[model samples]
Target: EIVAAVESVLAPQRAGRLAGRKVLVTAGPTHEPIDPVRYIANRSSGRQGFAIAAAAAEEGADVVLVSGPVSLADPPGVNVVRVETAREMMAAVESALPVDAAVMTAAVADWRTEADSGHKIKKDGSGRPPALVLVENPDILATLGHHPSARPKLLVGFAAETDDLIANARAKLDRKGCDWIVANDVNPETGNMGGAFNTVRIVSRAGIEEWPRLAKEDVARRLVGRIADHFAGA
Candidate 1:
């Protein structure tokens, strides 16, 4: 209901700007299992990416959403692919590629336990805590952005940061080889990470587009509209 109302105001009534275009969007926090009973995850709720999927669909694009373990319902008119770990998400994204554009908002865990126990680790009388070894996870964003054969024309990444947001986003653009970066302050105090509203700055080689705080649905609509422009001008 809330998403519908918000889209009413922001989304175009009938825009086919992205007609026949294929867009891929990744959303939510991927959980990396440490053990049979434990895992690592973040605070992402998947609202933003779902909204983007909805908005893209509204623009007449064929949208494929590769999502993490989010509780939210799948957006209408979009094909959704569910995943639990960063590796799974990476694979799903790759399989859905050859897309016209991509928006990666999944808070993929940077590291995962090097070896997860087949069985839950039991606490023995050993007073010492079990030492956990972690290894860096696959860099999905970078991999897709730099994919020579299947790279999307426009690859967008999200940088979740607490400080020096713009600087970090700019660096991410180069590091990830993405065309644009949506940098947002996710400080819990700001209530943006898992919140309904967002205040984001779009960073690209062209410059920065500082958007005002808006409902996540609104942000999605605007971003999708921009994506339409990107393809139209291409």
Candidate 2:
């Protein structure tokens, strides 16, 4: 007990690459409810994002991870905030401002029903399905990208695309105004959405850096290395 206490006291003095930096990460898929019983969501297991958070925390950054509904356990040495919808995610992200970096990895729903039904939606005897009106949800990345102030020094976004990967990532970099984008192919065949391995490209204004397929944990480590290099030079 005495040795453990001594080690704990001295641990904070260890100089890590991101020791004093603060980082914010968003993970998982937001649920857009249609009614009390049903919701719309994308394919996401939250593994990659959780891996990234774990990696960042390993480097000693003060990390805040905002996540949607997921079964994964929280990463060690990180502060986690749970959320359900895109709007709640936006709010949680905004509240964790003034960080050195922000990673938007959540697969947020683009549109939500104009009005969610309070009760379960059921079919009547008419054999006609109920119509749902959808409206655009808040653009979390864009909001942070164009934030008047309190924007993080490094803003990273993720793009899961089925086609035109680089082109789409480039467009998103400009449209969302983020510093970097981690692009990946999530086609059903690729199996990246919920798989253990991932193939990704790091897209920035400078150019694209293609990384060979790797385990989700290795990808996280490599990304954290890049982040450390970025701060080392900054």
Best by lDDT: 2
Clashing pairs in 2: none
Q: Write the per-residue lDDT of candidate 2 for residues 1-234, one digit (tens) a residue.
A: 999999988777436788888999999999999988899997789999999999999998999999999899999998999999999999999999988999888999999899988899888979998998999999999999999998789999999999999999999999999999999899889888899999999999999999999999999999988998999995
**lDDT of candidate model 2 versus the reference:** 0.92
Model 1 regions more than 4 Å off: 1-15
Worst window of 10 by summed lDDT in candidate 2: 8-17
Misplaced by over 4 Å in model 2 are 1-14
